[model samples]
Target: MRNTFLKASFMAAMASIGAGEAGAADYRKNPFTLAYDGAITQNEPGKVNIHPVTYKLNGLDIAANVYIPANYDPKQAYPTVVVAHPNGGVKEQVAGLYAQRLAEQGYITITADAAYQGASAGQPRSTDKPAYRIEDIHGMADFISQYAGVDRKRLGLLGICGGGGYSLAAAQTDKRFKSVATISMFNSGRVRRNGYNDSQLNSVQQRLQQASEARAQEAAGAAVLYSGDANLSDEQIAKLPFELYRQGYEYYWKTHAHPNSTFKYTTSSLLDLMRFDATDQIALIGQPLLMIAGSEADSLYMTEDAFAKASGAHDKELFIIEGATHIETYWVPKYVDAAIGKLSAFYGKTL
Candidate 1:
């Protein structure tokens, strides 16, 4: 009986995606639809302009978007920030939203699709290795620091979700970033290793063994095995135990669906991810730091843990959006506004 109900719910979700009933707004031309009040539809004269860019990173073609502030002049130096997307996200979603908003606030911003995901080039795709992810952040800094009108000394970083964790890791050694910030930071390593909030502590060894087998399969030139790839009905999504996963499905799979965005990664990637920790060398980040999270988010503990260990930063702050959940911080207007407001002030003062 329970199986029958779940099957019905899954079918309903798939039907909704097929029928294009994910949201009222059309997605084909406006996949950037979130609750952002004044989002730009096109690059009009005297408005923020988006530049589609591609650069080579470790032999892979990395795609990115550079948002230039209105009245941009290549001759004048400008402070720039690199926005990194969440684990399974592409550059056109939340990352781009924050980049656009920052540009509107008079700062140059760039958001890039990670090398192995989105429109970027990579093989055996969706490999979520930590080294590659951290390298992606470094690659962004390498390209954006040299961009026309950018003041290399005033470079900053804003990472969301899994990207936030990588930003913390990247900024630890990349002193080029004058300031670093994260929103709804997810300690990918901790979560992947022990499950969300350490709920899977007992399964750590078992998962490691599974990851090892996946790696062996890849070594034998067999088909790649992945994890976390699922197609669910709206009803199934609604019934998800965690608010983060539930709303995540709605945001990524429905309202903001993009051809490249996915929630899957090569199972072998966990071998490296399980060993990483965003707070490992956090104290080495001497630059000013800001961590933001929804007060009600299940992921709040990750931010708090990292914040508490970021003792090297002479100036650090942990700000919470009063009523937001994890996904709400991604698109909800009020929460986004509060985050951007704090970001503007923080960057304005530091950069």
Candidate 2:
């Protein structure tokens, strides 16, 4: 009788473990959660529709969210926007908000989980491999081109936050996207190597040494330690940046929220981004380009630098969304509205 009870208990425990796999997989890799106030978009079911889907790229099962306009017709091919999300974020988070709004404005929009993170495939998951991130964007282009009811020839691209950087890199190589835009972007490699605004350039060697230690510890079978999210306490928030990141967090995680999502990010992804540079082929992107950033944004600096260096476009324009911060522009009303309007016009004109 004792043996039978123990056996039954063990079986029940196993069943519960099996039931938690989906959340377990993501949380173990990243415990942080992102918040978004997308009720206006997500719950408003009529004029826009979002479908969840997955695709495989670089051995990663990338998760994506596709948005179709309310007026969408199965018999018609619609212009598509392949979107990439900010770092430490997912398709269900900020990117979906952006894509859905764009869809409501009449464009077929798709946003994806970066490879090695989110629902995408990458073992030793969430390593934040810059190459894999870039590949994921390229993979998305392929994913959309082959999607049903999409006009492959009439495609555009949009990247948000760090995704903006990757999109820039991908667009230089894949001309299938005739237009591209970035919002509150980051040059992941440069920032990883140098720290925000070169403030840590002097510490690159030390940082690299620390990364080596992390690599060795992993090699020796130590559990990975992540530093991306503070998992901030109320006290910590008081001492944090008064702008960009924290404000955005309040909006996305605290107030307006997506129950299925959070701001979680992989622990080891940052170290790999140190070597990633998306600006190497700016001259190669011959399509229409638009960069949207808040003049007051901490991230706007990188956007400005990239715009200055981008060589392809008499067709490119950089617009500073006047009074906003990096995170505010993520899903805030006025900002999102301006962005959708701008993007719709840009793609409408280009594609």
Candidate 3:
């Protein structure tokens, strides 16, 4: 049972952003182009509004959405949150959902595609490196902080799934973030290096060697290689062993998929990923922290371990949503509400 659970999580992490071709019809159902349920169709003067924006990060144009509260006034200062998306995720998905919800609660929020993923520009696309992901969080902070009516001292962060892991790394040294939080936190480096729950521990060196070879091939003018890219049929997906895997496929490839989202990453990226650990130097984050996870989430262990090692966060707390799984926390209304409610209180007290 334990091995099955671990294997399911490992495979789920690998395929969380399953591959699919988006057509004109998949451009999104709403004017804002957000793929999540209850996404705002049109901005209203007295309601939460989403602004599409682009900014340069490391010379690459980063696509992002900024959500401002209802009756927003430039003259009135407001606390702000920067949300980081999950692995193979784009700003248009769950990250945007949480950002918009938080905005509706009177906070300014922003969710951007990580460099080289989603609508963001980068060559040899879908490059998933730890440094780039961490910097993306910082870059969002830079842009959002300068926006009108932002209170620099009250800036907060919310990282979802893989973004949660990278955000922990970013907050370690980026003191600019006044408060930090993670929902359904996934430690990407740990999963990539050790496999989910360390089920692939014995093959770590072998995988590293493969990544090194892939990097060499890329340097020698070979075609870029990808990993975790799959176009599974419904029957194939149904036979998957775990709830996380089955539900994740439905979420990313079926119900809430967006064109910019893809499950693959440069195989060479494993070189950097294997060496990265989100919990490394985690104690450097001395700011107040809030870590939320679903009680039934197969990925809950990651959150638990990280929260335990957050020795530097003197005011950290872990809130769990009962009966919620890893992916459920992303879009299930009641679960999302539970998370947002806790986030509201956490940011309210800390920020």
Candidate 4:
């Protein structure tokens, strides 16, 4: 049995974040348990339909949703896109929103919960490593390319936030994604190694030491340590320094909260995160690339940095949504429309 004290502490921590009772309620009432606005309540003939799926990736079961366009005919090939979710985000959030939107545009799309996060299976839950995240993208491609009505040769990829960064790394050599796109790209490695916007650059070594200690503790069969877990009041959330985080809290905890989504990851995973940079092999991506960011987002620098380094990407473009911030791009109606417009055009031309 797991250590009682550690298990209790973990449960307490989770409780402080948000309640999963609502999610349970959703599942019992709505078969799909979808929480987004305009989500399909039921699959009607000749209309967009969502299929909940589970597949094996490595040895883990990946929970995912596959969206097929209206009047679907499996015999005919359709361009497909593998949409990757943001860090701490689940398939029911922005990823599912985008997948559904893409499906409405007459393309097949899929979004999955990364292994070790959301509803996926893994030990030491929330153990987020770049390799695993990148592999998740590859795993999505492997499954979706072979999906009915999908054109393997015309497959594309869209990574949101942290998923954007991982998508960059995955497409560096995957070659399967003919076109790549990122919305509000976040460089997880840079942020973890340094700090948000290099704010804690001076404490890099100290954080590394802490991460080492966490790993050591885990190796010794001690309790797991997590990072980025927080419980703050509404006023406290408002006082958060960056617009990205302030709005992120609202998006994740208040407006669009979900049972499985969280902001925490294994603290020991920093050992891998500190050394992994999304732009390391970016020049190897010869496919078309489209990176989108909000004009007013403090996290826009990350997208700019990665886009600049994608030297080998053909038809590369950095499109910015006017007057929008990082989190705003996730769900705000106008911003979402802007992003979808750009994505549709890009995928239509490339795929």
lDDT of each: 0.87, 0.72, 0.88, 0.90
Superposed on all Cα atoms, model 2 deviates from the true structure by an RMSD in Å of 7.3
- Ranking of models by lDDT: 4, 3, 1, 2
What are the per-model numbers of colliding residue pairs? 2, 14, 1, 0
The candidate with the higher TM-score, 1 or 2, is: 1
| Predicted structure with the largest lDDT when compared to the true one | 4
TM-score-based ranking: 4, 1, 3, 2
Best by TM-score: 4
Worst 10 residues of 3 by lDDT: 18-27
Question: TM-score for every candidate vs. truth?
Answer: 0.93, 0.84, 0.92, 0.93
Q: Which residue pairs clash in candidate 4?
A: none
Which runs of model 4 end up more than 4 angstroms from their true locations? Answer: 1-30
**Reference-based TM-score, model 4:** 0.93
Candidate 3 off by > 4 Å: 1-27
Please give the range of 10 consecutive residues that has the lowest summed lDDT in model 1.
28-37
Sequence-dependent TM-score of model 3: 0.92
lDDT per residue as tens, model 4, 1-351: 224433554465356545654432132245676656677889999999999999999989889999999999999999999999999989988898899999999999999999888777787888999999999999999999889999999999999999999999999999999999999999999999989988999999999999999999999999999999887899999898888899888787766766677899999999999999999989999999999999999999999999889999868999999999998898888999999999999999999
